[model samples]
Target: MTQPVSKTSVLAGMTSRALVIAALVVIVAACLPMVLSSYQVGLATEVLIFGVLAMSIDILAGFAGRTSLGHGAIFGVSTYVVVYATGQAGLSPWAGFALGVLAATAVASVFALLAVRTSGVYFPLLTLALGMIVWGVCLRWTQVTGGENGMRADVRPAALMSHSAFYWAVLAGAVVVSFAMWRFVRSPFGLTLRGIRDSESRMRSLGYNVPLHLFIGFTVSGIFAGIAGGLYAMFNNFVSPSTVALAQSVEGVLMMIAGGVGTLFGAFVGAAAIIVLENIVSSYTERWLMVLGITFVLIMIFAPEGIIGKLRAITSRKVR
Candidate 1:
C-alpha cells in the first residue's frame, strides 16, 4: 500500500517551489527595463502598483471572505495625502509616503468599524456606499484635492528620475510587499482568517474574535493598498477624483478574480494581462470598455477558476 504523505513534507516542497519561482520572477523583472521602451517601462510600473492593490483585495475578498468596494477610497486617500504632503506641505518624499500610508490605514479602520459586523452582500454594499462618499469628497473638496482638476505632484527623488531607475524602485517595492503578504497569509493568524472565511459561526464558537480578526485583516490590506497608491502617485505625478471612483475598486477586484482570487502572485499575472490588453485594444478601438466586458464574460464562462487557478489544478493533476 502507498503511504500517506506527511503535511510537513508537502509544506517543505511547496516552499522550495515558491522560492524557485520567486527567484525566476526577480531575474525577469530585473531584465525587463533593459529591453522595453520608456513608455513600456512606465506601463510595467503601473502593473506592479495595481498588482499590489489586487493582492490587497485578495487578503480581504479571498481570505477573509469580506469584499470591499471602498478599497479605492482607501487607496486614493493615500495618493491624495502623498500629493498634498509632498506638494502643498513641501515635505520630503519619504515623509509624504509615511503620511499617505497612515491616511489609508485610518480610512480602512473607519471602514472596518462600520462594515466588519456585516456579512455576505451587506458588507460589499456598505463598502460601496463608503466609497461613494470618498468619491464625492474628492469631487467637492476644491482646495485640498483640487476638486475635479485634481492634484499634481512630482514626488520622485533625484535618484529615481530615469524611467529604468523608477521601474527598478517600483519592482523592489513590489517584491517586498509581495513577500510580506505571502508571509502573512502563511502565518497562524492567516490560518484563522481562512477558518473564519470557511465558517464564521464555527470560528466564533471556537472562541475566535471574528470581527476583530476581520478588522485586523482589513487594516493590513489597507496598508498594502496604501503602499500601492503611494507608488502610483509617484509614477503618474498626479491624482484626480477618478482615482477614488467605484470603477477603480471594481477593476482591482476584477484583477484579483482574473488572476485567481486566493493566489497572491496571480495578481501580477492578471494585472499584466489586463493592463497590456487594455493598452493594445485601446490603440485600435474606441469601444475598449465593451471589449473588456466581453473578455470578462469569456473568462467567467470558460475559466471560472481563473488563469492561475486553472494552471494550478492542471499541475496538481499531472503531479498526481
Candidate 2:
C-alpha cells in the first residue's frame, strides 16, 4: 500500500532537515537584536551561559557516563579567578579568562584523579563533597573572595559594554563551543568514551585506561565550564560564593536531564526552558522552587527520557 523509502532518500531528508533548522536558528539569532530590548538580550546572554554549563555536564554524563555533582564548584572557581585576576590583580579581562580556564582545568584534574577511582553513587558524592569544600573556602576567604559581599569587576570590557556586541559574542561562543562538542562526540576518543560508559570492565579488558579517559573528559568539561563562568562573571560584573553552591550543581543536572541526556541540542533547550519558566513563575510567587520541583517530578514520571527524546521516539514510530 505504501512505497518504501530508500537509504538515499532517508539521508537526503535528514540533511535537508538539518539545513533548514540551521538556517532558522541563524535567521532568528540575527533578527533578535533588532527586535528585542537590551534587557531581553541580557536574559538571552544568561541563557547562553547556562547552556554552556549544561553542555559541560552533558560531556561527562551523556558521553562519558560520569555523574559529577561538583561542576558548579569548577564554574565558581573560574568566576573567582576572573574576579580576582581582573578586578583585584589588575590584569586584563583576557588574562583573567585564561587564568579562569587554567584554574578550572587544574581543579578538575585533581577531582577526576580522586573521583574516577570510584564509580556509581560514590563518584557523585565525592564530587559533591569537594564542591562543598570549595564553597566553604569561598565563603570564608574574605581577603581574596570578598566573603558574602561578593567580588565585582572594576569595569566591563569595551567589547561587551554594548548590548548588541555582547549578544553576538555570546551567541557566537555558544555556537562554536557546541560545534566543538559535537565533533568531540563523533571522534575516536568519543567512541572509546562511549565504550567505556557502556562497560568499563570490558574497556579495561580491551587495554583501555578507563580512569585516564575519564580524567581527560572531566578536565575538558571543566575547561568549558570555566569559560562559561568567565562569560557569566563578565556579563554580571560580579562573582559570589552562592554561584558555586550545591543547588547550582543540582540545577545543572536537572537541565541536562530535562533536555535529553545524550542529545547535544537538548542542553540548550533545557536551559532555555528552565530560564523562561523561572522568570515567569518567579513573577507570581517566591515559592517557584516548589512548583519547579513538582513540575520536574511530573516530567520524570511522564517523559523520563525528556522532551527531545520523546519527540524522537514518536518520529521513529511514525517512520516505522
Candidate 3:
C-alpha cells in the first residue's frame, strides 16, 4: 500500500516551492541588466515601483475592505515633498526620502482619522474629496509647487546616478517593501483586518476595534505608497500634479482588481501586465488603451478571482 504524505511534508514542500520562486525572481532581475537597454531597465524599474503602489491599494481593498479613489494624492504628495526637499531645500537624498515618507504617513493618518468614521462608498468619496484638496494646493500654489509646469530636481546621489545603480537601489527598496507587507498580512493584525473586512458588525460584537484597525491598515499602506512615490520622483527627477491626478488613482484600482485583490504576489503581477501592455504595446499601436480595456474586461470575465487566486486553486486541487 502507498503511504500518505504527512502534514509536515506538505508544509516543507510549500516552503521549498516559495524559496525556489523567490530565487528565480532574483536571478531574472539580476540578468536583465545584461540584455535590457538602459531605457528598458528604467521601464522595468518603474513596474516594480508601481507594483509597490498597487500592493498598497491591495492592503486597503483586499485586507481592510476599504477602497480609496484618491490614493494617488498620497503618492503624489510624498513625491512633491521629496522633490522640494532635495531641489529647493538642498537636502540629501536620504533625508528627503525620510521626510517624504513621514509626510505621506502623516497625511494618510489625518485622512484615516475621518475616513474610518464612514464605511463602504462614503469612505472612498471622503478620500477623493480630501485628495482633491491636495491637488488644488499643488495647482494653485505655483510659487511653491510650480503649478502645472511641475518642478525638476535630481534626487539621486552621485553614486546612484547611473541607470543600473538606480535600478538596483529601487529593486532593493521594492524587495524590502514587498517582504514587510507580506509579513504584515500574515500577522495577527492582518487577521484582524480581515475579520473587519469580512463583516464589521461581527468583529465589533467580538469586541474588536474595527475602525481603529482599518485606520492603521490604511496608514501603513500609505507609507508603502509613499516609498513608491519617493522612488518614482528619484527615478524621473521630476515631480508634477500629473502624478496625483484622478487617472492615476483609477489605474491603481485597475491594477489591484486585475491582479487579484488580497494577493501581494498578484499585485506585482498585475502591475507588470498593465505596465507592459501600456508601455510595450503602445509603441506599436495607437489603440493601446482599447487593447488594455479589452484585456481588463477579459480578465474580469474569465478570471475574476485574479491570476494568483486561479493559480492557488489549481495548486490546491493538485495537492488534494
Candidate 4:
C-alpha cells in the first residue's frame, strides 16, 4: 500500500510553494518599470494602491463578516488629511502620512462604534449613509477641500520624483502591507475574527467579545485603507471629492470579490485585472462601464469564489 501522507508534510509543501510563488511575483514586479512606459508604470502603482484598499475590504467582508460601505469615507478622510498637512500646513511627507493614517483610524473607529451592532443588510445600509456624510463634507468643505476642484499636494519625497522611483516606493509599500495582512489573517486574533464571522453568537457564548473584535478589525482595516489613500494622493498629487464617494467604496469591494474574497494576495490580482481592463477597454469604446458590469455579472455566475479562489480549487483537485 502507498504510505499515508502526513498533514504536516502537506502543509509544509504548500507553504514552500507559496513562498516560491511570492518570490517570483516580487521579481516580476521589480522588473516592470524596465519594460513599461511611464503611464503604464503609474497604472501599476495605482493597482498596488487599490490592491491595498481591496485587501482592507477583504479583512472586513471576508474575515469579520461585515461589509462596509463607509470605507471610502475612511480612505477619503486620510487622503484629505494628507493633502492638508502636506499642502496647507507645509508639513513633511512623513508627518502627513502619520496624520492621514491617524485620521482614517479615527473615522473607522467612529463608524465601527455606531454600526457594528447591526448585521446583514442593515450593516451595509448604515455604512452607506455614513459614507454619504463624508462625501457631502468633501463637496461642501470648500475652504480646505477646494470644493469640486479638489486639492493638490505633492507628498512624494524629492528622491522619488521619477516615475520609476515612485513605482518602486509604492511596490515596497505594497509588499510590506501584503506581509502585514498575511500575518494578521493568520494570527490568533485573526482566527478569532474568523470564528466570530462564522458564528457570532457561538463565539459570544464562548466568552469572546464579538463587538470589540469587530471594532478592532474595522479600525485596522481602515489603517490599511488609509495607507492606500495616502499613496494614491501622492501618486496623483491631488485629492478630490471623487476619492471619497460611494462609487470608490463599491469599486474596492468589487476588486476584493474579483480577486478572491478571503485570499489576501488575490486583491492584487483583482486590482491588476480591473485596472488593466479599464485602460485597455476604455481606449476601444466609450461603453467600458457596460463591459465591466457584464464582466462582473459573468464572474458572479461562473466564478463566484473569485479568480484566485477558483484557481486554488483547481489546484487542490489536481493534487488530490
Model 3, 6-123: lDDT tens per residue? Answer: 2223433436667557656766775776799998898888888888999998889888888887788888889999999999999999899999999899998998899999998998
lDDT of 2 at 241: 89
- For 218-277, candidate 2 gives per-residue lDDT tens digits of 898898888888888788889888898887787777788889998876888888888888
Q: Looking at candidate 1, what is the lDDT of residue 44?
A: 93
> Tens-digit lDDT track for model 1 on 1-320?
00111222344344666666667777788789989999999999999999999999999888888878888888999999999999999999999999999999999999999888899999999999999999999999897899999989888887999999999888888887887787788789999999998999999999999999999999999999999998888998899999998878977877888899898889999899888888999999988778877877888898777788878889999999
Give me the candidate number with maximum TM-score.
1
Error of 3 at 254 (Å): 1.4
Alpha-carbon runs more than 4 Å astray in model 3: 1-14, 284-303, 307-320
The TM-score obtained by model 1 is 0.91
TM-score order, best first, reads 1, 4, 2, 3
Give the poorly placed runs of model 2, Cα more than 4 Å off. 1-20, 311-320
Off by over 4 Å in 1: 1-14, 311-320
Give per-model TM-scores: 0.91, 0.90, 0.88, 0.90
Best by lDDT: 1
Rate residue 191 of model 1 by lDDT. Answer: 92
Cα distance off (Å), candidate 3, residue 229: 0.5
Can you rank all candidates by lDDT, best first? 1, 4, 3, 2
- Give the per-residue Cα lDDT of candidate 1 at 214: 92
